[model samples]
Target: MLQIYNTLSRSKQLFKPIVPGKVKMYVCGMTVYDFCHIGHARVMIVFDMVVRWLRASGYEVIYVRNITDIDDKIINRAIENGEPISALTKRFIDAMHADSDELGLMHPDQEPRATDYIAKMQGMIGKLIENELAYQADDGDVNFAVRLFPNYGSLSGKSLDELNAGERVVISGGKRDPLDFALWKSAKPEEPVDTRWKSPWGEGRPGWHIECSAMSCELLGEHFDIHGGGADLQFPHHENEIAQSEGALYGKDRKLEDAPFVNYWMHNGHIRVNEEKMSKSLGNFFLIRDVLKSFDPEVLRFFMLKAHYRSPINYSDAQLEEARAGLVRLYTALAQVTLSQAVKAELTDLQNPWVMRFTQAMNDDFNTPEAIAVLFDLASEVNRTQGDEKLVLASTLQSLGGVLNFLQRDPTSFLQSGTKDEEGLCPAMIDEQIAARVAAKNAKDFAQADSIRKALLAQGIVLEDKPGGITEWRRA
Candidate 1:
């Protein structure tokens, strides 16, 4: 009983998979021309959260996030770097995986590269041509006839007239209509030879829109449960995907086009930095690896989840520091319990009131911000109690966090591993300082003990002196 905000429907609806207990989802993944930015990171984390929740709800999920390994950007970057397209794409794909690993992302069940599905794309394009939904342009490129598809702008909620008026589509010389998009692009003489595939429409490559249509249909059938991507893709990319997929493949007679292409469409919002869109032209673009340099990977993940997936998240040092502090507070509560108990414990009692509330929040459109509030409340309870109740509360906190792939680290290690500061105190140094402070307090040198506490505080570390002279320290 989960309600999801479907972009196509423009409202929250109950999620019902095509198959009873199975979910087949396709998310448009990274276009590997360069390192993934914070925008790309949001797409990665948002869908990851979705997949985690779906599986936790007892559904078998086959998540497929496609990689655009062969795109115009990839080709241009390869040419600029004076390397083969394969070499350029390989480096970026590896970098993307490293970032994914650091962010604790689950690998998609199938990551189909666009290059491998050229035959499928060609087949779909040929079918469209046969149905008269597509035509080969005078320039040897095949373009989808948008006018023939009556529901072309349904996903984006814009009519052909509205799209034509608002959109500034550059009219290609051979295109019959400005709004028509290419299904197959004829190769250019200057482009890489390997980038071109021999198709019925001469030596060219699949257009950006057709790639997803072909790959998703080939892997997940003509229709699937969910299709997700960034909001920017809603207009031409996803709208065109719906057009081509349904225009050629779906429906009984193909002309009526009555079948749905994708059941639910989910789009994660954009990432803005300091109230502006994150872009290279604006000088606020941050690569995922670069942000991971300053903040812990968990901190970055938490930052993205702090806001609802559909809401635009503001990225700044202050926001990240706040996220870091909030995550530290959650981990600090877990640190109160023994590491073995915290890690090994499971939520056997789903009927617990807190669990019920958490499930309610998560079921309502993956309301992570609300679900996370339950964690904070649980942590507060864990900190105030002891013995059996505290054990249960702490275990519940860890179990709930694990549903979102959070709170899996050893609490002590997680608390101590602060941000990457070259001049800041390391764990050994902090421990040495704490030992000195403890020794001074034991020897009745109150002034020296006070001095050590003040010094550590000035270095962005907080110390809590517990009974029996145990001092716990964490980055402030």
Candidate 2:
């Protein structure tokens, strides 16, 4: 049985789906105003890993990651670029998909966009207003009454007093309480006409928090198994989601325990750079495509899994190079053996020790680092064994890696891809250099052979001289 770390409970608990053998999960996805950064990649890949593992454990999973296509950011970017909101959002949405594909992410079962659910959001807001949990302010904005919801800060583990103390004083905008947040935002006169929708609160758009509440409940039902996003969203965004969703479901008479909105809350940690959080203001933030220019997509995926999902991962060229080398070693082991039909047929035996260990690690809160350790162990065994036994070990390695969406490529293709370095020597050129070195060694020109090795190593290429005078190389 799998145990997951529920952020709401602040501890690991046994995972029990609301429906037996089925899981319905909602994750807050990208706000598509620009290209996805490494932070966004972590959310997509982390949840992708979770959904994959759940299905692998024999549960049917309905994974929905919503897209925020109609947000303030989108509107502003569109206005700045003098394009329609649809045009701006579509470009980034397509870019997101391309980035996801490059990172080997599986498409969510349902990707609900915010614009399509305006009617549902309006209906939700109206219910809250009728129940007196929400009110239309003098500015025409509808705001959720945080004071009426007693458990408003439960998700973030902060009391209302604490939140209020931390909040900056600003014009209340007709809100009865300072902590109250928008359910619907009244449109500004300068905003595009298409961005506004006719609602009970006048022509305006749904607030960011309300969009997820409406979409998640409408698609996944009033309650679901899991709700997840980055650690940054735990406060304000997800906390508000909890208050709004549950408040809407139970009305003014609602207690915190009246009904559960999400059984488990999970959050993946942030991506840091040089021990500082990666952000645009700091100038250390990296776009997915920018990183892909120097490393293979799978290398980036492998780098992420190398750390526990809940722990902060630092991004550096050296760290990525290390991940690349690790991948090369795993693929190298696969290259030495053939997974014949006979060997592959035997891979269905889940009772195999290596598979059992991998499953155990994954079951313990998706401990991918431990699971990957098992792959390295299996790879070692493959290198040490021979004939049919080696083939079996290699097949097991591939099968276990497939569970985590790794190592399914042809080993040769992966090894020769050369880390996507545009200016670096190609695989064929490296091979030619290796051939020349081999010839130089055979002709007794030891100095020439040494010079070739040093030249290649200078370009971040590492060459390994194996038994029987065989030479192999990989990007360092």
Candidate 3:
């Protein structure tokens, strides 16, 4: 049985789909005001791997990640750029798809947009209002009453008595409590785009939280298998979603016995740059495009998989280089295995131990880093054996490794694609220069060669020359 870590229960659980072979999952998607970033990529690719593994294990998965196309952030960004909100949002959505595809994340089973589900949003809010789960304010805004839902803090583990609304919260009159969130917002008279709809209350737009609840329920169902997002969403965003979705389920006429929202919850940890949480104030935030321009997108994806999904991944130039090298090694190692001589399309018994190890590690809760370690071990073993003796096993190893999506390329081609440009100080190149300098020393052109190697050393490559006229180089 496949096992997965569920944030809701705070434990690793056997993953038996509620509908047997079918999986219904909803993940919070991009806010669409800015270009996607590495932070966004982590959640995308993590869930992508989850789906990949599930499918590989024989489960049919239906994944939905909703795009929050309309939000305060989008409106403000559009105004600043002097462009229509729709144009700005469309640009971002397209950019998101480009970067996401570049990183090799499979598109979600359904990519729901908030703007497309306005009517469903209104109907859900109407239900909340009718059930006393929501209320309308004097200013034509609707807010979910915090005190009305006894399970309000179940997701975030905070009580109404302790939680306070801050920056992301909107100030409004209809709210009975400060902690209550908007279900609908009254459009500003000069708000550029028509961020309003003719609701029973008046012409206004749906709030951020309601969009996910309405859209996910409308597309996926009233209750789904899993809901996932960044760790940051554990607060008001996801917490409120659980409240609304769960409340709707509990209030169902059918009186379902299970939790109303989701049977599972998965969260990825934060990402940091220079040991600091990436933030606008620090001037260190990197867009996904920006990083992709500097390094292979797979390098970033590999770097992410290097750490457990639940651990904060600290990123730096050194770390990226390490990830690049590590990936190249795995790729190269797999490529070195000879498989063409196989008489039949059969996997060797040698493939079993590694598969069991990899499966056990992953089944322990998608331990990718650990599973990759198992892969490296298997690669080493594969390298130790060659020829037809390892043929069938080698093919099986190659095929299964390909399923991980990180081991398809030949290590040599992937590394020597001439991806190394003047950018990214490569230590291997630096070392080669050092070896050249050593060669100059052997030729007694000490001064010239010393200068040459010194110039190379400054660039961070190290070289070692053997007495037998052999040289090996590595990045310093």
Candidate 4:
């Protein structure tokens, strides 16, 4: 049995899928106006880990992560670049996928783009309007009446008074109430022609918050098992999703039901840099490719899983270097043993203490930090054992790592390659230095050999002189 921390309930609860052996989950995905930052990567990796663990736990999971292709940000970026909206969105979408692939993320079972779900959004909006939970404003935009939805602030755990206290006095933007949010926005003259669509509320596009509700309902049905996103979205975005989705009536039932729209809500904490949240305004924003220039993609992945998904993770060079060293130790252990391919099949055996511990850690709210400690333990066991027993333990280590999408590479290759340092020698240059050191040693020029070894070591390369005159090298 597995338990997960449901943000809606504010506590960890036993996971009971709507369908006993099946799970249908929807996660709010990237808004493709720009390159994905570390924050975006965390959401992708966190939910992907959830999906992986659920499937590993013998549940059939239908994972849907929707793309917001028609947001104001996307339109503005396209206009700034003097490109078509489709072209701008496609470019970023490809970049996003490239980033996801580099970070070793699994493709969602269905990635529904918001632009494709316009009609579904309109349909939902229509239902909200009919239920009097929504109305077309004087400006031709349709807005959800937040005050009318009695449970509007429940998802965010804020009372209307508390939410009202934070409201600023500004032009209401044609909203009847300051707290009301747009379900459909009427297009302006300056906006691109393609950005608008013919709808009952005149010509406009769907709002940001409504996109998830429409896509999730249309693809995963009226109600699903899980809905997730970043912690930043918990307030206005996810809270509005709950209002629109739960506030509407569906099927033969013409009244709002008591049943919740989503059974469980999950949110991953933010990524912080230098004791502050990573944001562009602070000038500390990092793009995924930019960070990958210095560290291996797997190292970044390992760094993320080193912290509990619900906890904020700080990003710095020191943290990443520590992650690389930890990953190298695991790979180093694997390199020392010859493993049998069939040994991985024994992962389900509860008799294995390591497997039992790893399973327990993962089952308790996907506590990856604790689960990763089990990997370190297994690696130590592999190092302490010998012959066939060592091989079995090493193989089991690889198998368990696979459940979390780690340690699938050849250990030798992973150890020798992957890390990047601009000031350090390239692979060919390092090999040349090693060959020179080897030649010097063979000629009995001990002083020159020591000098060469020292030079390479200074440049972040470690050399291991092995049996049969073989030299092994890896980045330090």
Candidate 5:
């Protein structure tokens, strides 16, 4: 049985799906105005690990990560570039997929785009207005009545008074309360024609909070097993979702306990730079593609998992290089072993102590750090053993890593393909150099062999001489 930390409850609880043997999960996905950054990468990898674990545990998982394809950012970027909103969003969407593919992310079962569910959003907003939970402001914008919803700040654990005190300069639109958020934004005269929709609230578009509420309810019903996002969304965005969704579901008589929108609320912590939150405004955020230029995609994935999901992970080149070294060690153990039929059969023996420990670690709040430690333990055993048993250990290591989408690449290729200077010295060139080194050693020319090793090492290539005069190399 898996236990996950529910942000709403503020403690770890046993996971029980609303439907037995099945899970319905909704995660707030990317706002595709630009390329995804490392912060976004954490969200993608964290939930992906959760879904993979659920399915591996014999539960059918229905994962839905919604895309915010029609947000204010998307609209502004389209106008700035003088392109259609669709064109701007499509490029980022494609880029997101490419980034996920490189990071070895499993696609969500359903990726509901915000634009695709405009009608549903409008219908839900109408329900709110009919119930008096939402009202069309004097400016024609529709805003949720936060005061009417008694449990408005429950998710964020802040009272209305606290929120008011902490509030920054409020946007003085037509909102009755400073804390009240938009359900529908009235269109502006200067806005592009494509940005507006013919809504009941006039020619306007759905607000960011309303889009998720509508799409999640329409796709996964009014209530679902898990709702997750980054910690930054815990305040207004997710809190607003809970208010609007429940308000529409149970009307003005809604109580927090009466009808819940989500059972378990999970939020992964942020990625920081030098203990500061990574953000574009700070100029500290690193794009996924930018980081990929230097580090392997899997290395980035591993770096994110090195910390517990709820803990803030600091990003640095040194940290990534350390993660790369750790990954190299795991791959090295599996290099010589093959997944034979007998080895595959051995994996089914779940009673194996190492497998049991791995499962236990994963079950305890998806403790990937401990689970990853188990992999290192297994790797050590694989290194110390030989023959058929070693093959079984190697196969077991790969199988467990597959659950987290790691260690599946061909070991030899993974090891050799990570050379820092791919263009300067291709794999063939490295092999030729290694061949020369070997020939020098065979001729007892120690000086020449040492010189060759030094040159490769200077180029960020590490060479390991095996017992049988074989040399293995990887990027440093």
Candidate 6:
């Protein structure tokens, strides 16, 4: 069984899908105006782990994450780049996919684009207007009438009064209330490009909130199991989604059963860097690609899991180094165990406890940090033991490995990849150096041989002298 923190209920609930054995989870996706930052990394990998665990435990998850390629930012970016909106959005989506794959995320079952669902959005707008939940203003903008929806601010825990208090946009002449948000915005007469569509009211582009409401309704259903996004979006974007979805999904009678919309809401906390909020305006943001260039992708994934998903992760070079050392420790233990030709290694009934314990920790709440500690403990035991069956030991390590999403390949591969630069070479390069050291020792210059060994060690390489003066080395 799995447990998830449902922000709607403000409690951790036993995650029994509304339809047993199936989960319909919708995670809000990228805006596509820029590269995904480490903040986006937290959300991408955290849910990847969540989806992986649910699938591993025998549940069918239809995960739907949308790509928001149509909006102010995208339009502004296209204009700034002197390219079409299609070109700009496509370039970023490619970058986003590269970053996502590098982090080892499982692809969502459905990835809907906002631009594809304009018709569905128009339909929903028609329903809202008919129900008196929304109306067109004198300026040709259709706005959701916040005063008409009693549950308008429930999801964000903010009241209509609070929203009105901090309102920044121009309160259009005909808008009934200050809290009303735009469902569609008319293209200004003075604007250079007209990106609007022909709605019943006028030609206008769909608002940010309308796209999610319509896309989710069309892709999943009138109701889904979970709606997830960043904590920052909890207030206006999500609250607006609830209002718009609920308004159209039901009839005049307003029975809750008619429009079940979403049962659970989940929000992952923000990511900070070096105890400060990372922002592009602050010039403190790091792109996912830039970070990946220097660090192993799995190291980044492991770093994300170090803190709970609901807590803010502080991104820093120190944290990266710490994650690297932790990875080294894990792969080192895995390298020592040897697997046999048998698919299932020999395990006595008495020694089958550790992997079980690790699974228990993971199932509790996808508690990766705890599961990782369990892994290190198991690795330490395997490293300390003598006369143990190598096959059984390797199998034991493999068992815990899947849960961490680590140690899947040969441990030597991991160690080799990570230490190549530090070693100033790879296996082939080390072999060349070994021949030089051998020639020196052959000349009876033991001092030169010692010098070569010290040089390799300085590069984090360890050499072992073997039978007949042959030598092989691996990273220590």
**Candidate 2 local Cα displacement, residue 396, angstroms:** 1.1
TM-score quality measure for candidate 5 = 0.94
In candidate 6, stretches whose alpha carbon ends up further than 4 angstroms from where it belongs are 163-175, 190-194, 251-259, 340-352, 386-390, 419-423, 435-450, 462-476
TM-scores of all predicted structures: 0.96, 0.93, 0.86, 0.94, 0.94, 0.89
Per TM-score, the best of the predicted structures is 1
Clashing pairs in 2: none
lDDT: worst 10-residue window of model 2: 164-173
Mind giving the per-residue lDDT tens digits that candidate 3 earns over 169-197?
67666677888889999888878755667
1 or 2, greater by TM-score: 1
> Cα lDDT of all candidates, in order?
0.88, 0.88, 0.76, 0.87, 0.87, 0.78
Candidate 6 per-residue lDDT over residues 89-181, each given as its tens digit: 899999999999987777899999998999999999999988989989888889988878877677766777777423223477767787788
By the lDDT metric, which is better: model 1 or model 3?
1
Residue pairs with colliding backbones in model 6 are none
Off by over 4 Å in 1: 164-170, 250-257, 342-350
Q: What is the lDDT of residue 90 in candidate 4?
A: 94
Runs of candidate 3 with Cα error greater than 4 angstroms are 252-258, 338-351, 389-397, 418-420, 423-476
Measured with C-alpha atoms, the lDDT of residue 123 in candidate 3 is 87
Where model 5 places Cα greater than 4 Å from the true spot, the runs are 164-170, 255-257, 345-350, 419-424
lDDT of 4 by residue, 280-331 (tens): 7788988998888888888998999899999999999899999999999999
What tens-digit string does per-residue lDDT give for candidate 2 at 1-476? 79999998899999999999999999999999999999999999899999999988889999999999998878999999999998999999999999999898999999999999999999999888888899888988888888898777877787888885222123455788888888998999999997999986789999889999999999999989999999888888888898889888887677645658899999999899989998877988999999999888888999999999999999998999899889988999998876655255233356788877888899999999999999999999999999888888898888888888889998878877775756889888999999999999999999999999999999878888878878878765
Candidate 1 colliding pairs? none
lDDT score of residue 228 within candidate 3: 87
Error of 5 at 369 (Å): 1.0
